[model samples]
Target: MTLGFTALVTAIVGEVAGTMSLRKATTGSKAWFVAVAGSYVFAFSMLSVSLAQGLPLGLAYGIWAAAGVALTAILSKVLFEEPLTPVMGAGIALIVGGVLLIQVGSAY
Candidate 1:
C-alpha cells in the first residue's frame, strides 16, 4: 500500500479511538480525556502526513471521515452495547458510497 493510504488508515484509526475515548470521558472517567486529546492530535498529524505525501485533501478527508464514522459506530455498538439501528446502518452505507464516488472521481 502507498504511504499516503497507510497514513490515512492510521488517521482513521486514531480518530475512531479518540471518539471512543470521548464517550468514556463523558461517562466520568477523567483519565480517558487524556487519551482523547492524544488520539486526536495523532489523528490530525497523520492526516497531515497523508496530505504531505501527495494525497488530495478532498479524497483523503472524505475517506478518513467516512471510515472513522463507520468504524466508530460499529465499535461503539460492540464495545458499549449501543444501539445500531438499520437506519444508522443505511446512513453509514451512504457515507461509504459517497466516499467511493469521491475516490473514483479523483482518478480522472
Candidate 2:
C-alpha cells in the first residue's frame, strides 16, 4: 500500500488505542491515563506525516474517518458490550461505501 495509506492506518490504530486507554482509565484504573496521552500523540503525529506525504485531503480524511468509525464501533461492541444493530451495521457499510467512492473519484 501507499505511504499515505500506511500512515493513515497507523493513525487509526493509535487513535483506537488511545480511546481504549481512556475508557480503561475511566472505568478500570488510573494508570491507563498515561496511555491516553501517549497514544493521541502518536495518532496526531501519524496523521501529520500522512498529510505531509502529499495525500489529498479528501482521500486522507475520508479514509481516516471511515476506518475510525468502523473500528471504534467494533471496539465499542466488544469492549463495552455496546449494541450493534442492523441499522448501525448499515451505517458502517455506507461509510465504507462513501470512502471507496472518494478514493475512486480522487484517483481520477
Where model 2 places Cα greater than 4 Å from the true spot, the runs are none
Candidate 1 lDDT, 1-108, residue by residue in tens:
999999999999999999999999999779999999999999999999999999999999999999988999999999999999999999999999999998898889
TM-score of each: 0.96, 0.89
lDDT tens readout by residue for model 2, 1-108 = 889779989999999899888888999889999999999999989998899998887888888888888888899999899898999999999999999998888768
* Model 2, CA-based lDDT: 0.90
Alpha-carbon error at 5 in model 1, in Å? 0.7
Candidate 1: stretches off by over 4 Å: none
Whole-model lDDT values for every prediction: 0.95, 0.90
Candidate 2 TM-score, C-alpha based: 0.89
- Superpose all Cα atoms of candidate 2 onto the true structure and report the RMSD in Å to 1 decimal: 1.4
